[model samples]
Target: MSFKTIAAILQGEQEFQRVLDCAIPLASRLEAHLVGIHAEVLPVPYTAAAGFPDTDFIQVSTELNKEATLKLRGTFHERVEDAGLSFEWRTLESFSGDGTLAGLPNVRAADLIVAAQRDVESDDGTDVESLVYDAGRPVLMVPHSGPILSSFRRVLLAWNGSREAARATFDALPLLIEADQTDILIIDPPESSDDTPDAAGSRIAASLGRHGVSVGVSVRNSQGQSVETLIQDRLAASGADLLVLGAYSHSWLRELLFGGVTRSILRSAPVTVFLSR
Candidate 1:
C-alpha cells in the first residue's frame, strides 16, 4: 500500500530541520500528508506527604515545561512551513517518564516515522529514543550528524532470506519505486536455493520497475564477517543515501536481538535507514 501520511518526530534540536529535509522529498514523491510532532514532558505528580515547599517546586517546574513547549512548537512550525509542505504541528502532553516514548498517538496514525538516531549519553530518556522500537510502524531513522539525503537516487536493500526483511521491503516499496536506481544486495546469498528461503526481493524489484524504478539485482558473499559491517561498507561505497532492510533478525531467546546488519547500521549508519520489524 502507498503511504498517504508521513509523521516526523522532532525535539527542536539543531538537526531537526535536517530530519525534515530528508522526509519532505519522500512526502512529495508519495504526495502524502506531513506531520511534525514534539512531546511536552508533563509535571511530575506531587503528593501531600511531599509538603508545601515541594508543591511549590512542582508548580515552578510545570510552568517552565509549558514555556519550553511553546517555544519549541513555534520554532518547529516555522521550519515546517519553510520546507514548503503543509504540516500539522502538535505538542503532546503526557505524564509518562522519558523512557516511555510518550507519544503513542502520533505513532498510531503514521505510516512512517522519521527520527534522528540518538545515543545513550545524548538521550535524556525522551520519547525520541523509543520511536524505533515502539512505533509499530517502519521508522526511517536519520543519523544525528550527517548530510541530509536530497533524493533516493541510489539505494541498497540489505536482503536476507527472512520474514522481517520481506516486511521491510514491502514497507519501503513507495520509496524504492521512486528511487532513481535501486539494488537488491543480498550479502552472502546461499549457494543454492536450499540454504536460502525464497523471498520477495525479485517480486519487489518487478513491482518497482513497473512504477518506473531503475532496478538491478545481485548477491555476493560477505566473506564470513559480520553481515552488518559488509552492508554498511556496501552502502557507503555505492553512495546510497537510503538503506532499506528488516529491523530484527531473530527473537527466539525471549529477548530482542538485532540482526548483525541492523545493529551495525544503528552504530555507524552513514545515511538514512528505513526499517520495519
Candidate 2:
C-alpha cells in the first residue's frame, strides 16, 4: 500500500522545483521511486515552399525550444539531487499533436501522476490542460500556492456508487487505509429505507477494517448545497487533507449546461483530491 512510481511533468525551473518539493516528501514517506518527466514539445515545422522566404524560421524555433528544455533539465537534476531521493529524469521530444502525451509509455507505467497548476499564458495555456486529461493516471494536482502535504492523515471519500467513484476509492486505498482517520461520505438521492443498518457502507468498511484502518461511514442529504460547496464545507469542518472522488460526473457539455459534482471538484476543491474515471 505504497506508491511505487511517481511521475511529474516538468514545465519550468520555478514550477518544476515547486512540484518536486511537494512530491519528494511524499515519495520519501512512501519509499517510492520518483520519475521526473520533461515533456518537450518540439517546434512545429514550417517548410518554405519553392521561392518562399523565411528559411531559418524552423531552425531558430528548434534552437530556442532546445535551449529552454536544457535549462529545465538542469534545474530538475539539481532539485532531485538536493532531495537525495532515487529518481530518474526522462525527456520526450516531439511536435505536440492531439493525444501526444496520452501515448507516452512512461505515463502509463507510473503509479501516481503529480501535476502543478500552471498559470495561463504559458505554452499557450495548453500544457496543464493536456496533462490533466491525457496522463491516463490518477493525478494529484498541486496548487501553485498551498500547504504541501506530507501525509494523508485525514481523508474524505466522496462516494456516489458510480463506477468512477468505485475506481477512485480503490485507487486511493493505500492512503485511505493508512490515514489517521478515514470517513466515507455519501451524498445523493438519499439512503434507502430497505437498506440494512450496514449494507453497502459496511462492505467497504469491512475491507478497510481487514487492513486495520480506522474507518467510519455517514450519509448526508445535499440539502440544496452545490456539490462543490458541500465538499468544501466538509473539508473545512472535518479538517481532511485528501479527498477521493470520481472525475467528471457528467460529460463536459451536460455538466456545462447543468452543473455536475465532478466538474465542480475539478474546478476547485478545498483540499487535495484524488480522482479516477
Candidate 3:
C-alpha cells in the first residue's frame, strides 16, 4: 500500500520549484524513487498563402523551446542531486496542444503522481486533468498558493458512500493509517436503503478503525450551500493538512456540464488533495 515510485510533473519554471518542494520531501519520507517528467512543447508552423511552411518562425520557436527544456533539466538535476534521492528525468517533445500528454507513459508506470494545481489565469497548455483522469494512478495535487506540506499529519476524507469513495478510502490507506487523526466527513448524504443520514459516515469510520486508523465521523447538512464550499470551510476550520477524496465519481462529461463535486474541489481546494478515480 506504500508508494515505491513517484512521478512529479514539471510544467514550467514557475511551478518547478514548488512541485519539487513537495515531491522531494514526499519521496524522502517514503524512500521511493522519484521521476521528474517534463514535456517540451513544439510550436506549430504557420502555412503561407501558397501552403509553404514558415521556416523562420518554426526555427526560432524550436530553439527557444529547446533552451527552456535544457534550463529546466539543469535545474531538475541540480535539485535532485542535492536532495540525494534516487531519481531519473524523462523529457519528451510534444507536438500536440496538450504538453502534459508527453509524460503520460512515465506517469502510468509510477505508483503515484505529484502535480501542481492548475493555474486558471494562464493557458500554459499543460493537461493536468488528463493526467489525473487517465494516468491510472493516484495523484497528489499541490496547491498553487500555499506552504508545502512535509507530512500529512491530519487527514480529512470526503466520503459519499460511492464506489469511487470506497476506492479512494482504500487507496489512501497508507496515509490514513499513518495520520494522527483522520476524519471522515459526509455532507448532504443521500438516504440509502440500508444507511441513515445520522449514520452516514459510520460504515467507513468502522472500516478505517479496524485498520488501526484513529478515525472519527462527522455528518453535516449542506443547508443549501454547495458541497465544495462546505468542504473548504471544514478544511479551514479543522486545519487538516491533507484531503483525501475520490475523483469524478460522476462521469467526466457530466461534471463538465453540471459542475460536480470533484471538479469544484479540484479547482479550489484549500489543502493538498489526494485523488483516486
State each model's CA lDDT, in order.
0.71, 0.71, 0.85
Clashing pairs in 1: none
Q: Would you give me the overall lDDT of model 1?
A: 0.71
Off by over 4 Å in 1: 28-30, 45-53, 95-100, 125-129, 192-204, 252-259
lDDT tens digits by residue: candidate 3, 1-277: 7988999988788788888999998888899999988887788878867789988888888889889889989999898888889999888888863445877777888988888888777766356667778888888888888788857889989998888888888988888988999988998888978889987888789889999999988899988898888889889888899999998988999998988888887777868899988
User: Candidates ranked by lDDT, best first?
Assistant: 3, 2, 1
Best by lDDT: 3
Compose the digit string of candidate 2's lDDT tens values, residues 53-102.
55598678777877888887787777777778789888777676212263
Q: Which lDDT value does model 3 have at 249?
A: 86
lDDT for 14 in candidate 3 is 73
Error of 3 at 16 (Å): 1.2
When summed lDDT is taken over every stretch of 10 residues in candidate 2, the lowest stretch is 120-129
- In terms of lDDT, model 2 sits at 0.71
Candidate 1 lDDT over 1-277, as tens digits, reads 7888888776655546666777777676667788877776667766566454477767887898878777767876776577666678767766763322766666669898877766535643234425655677888887767777745778898777588888888788877876888888876655565444244357656776787878887666656777777787788678888998787676523233434546557656878888887
Candidate achieving higher TM-score, 2 or 3: 3
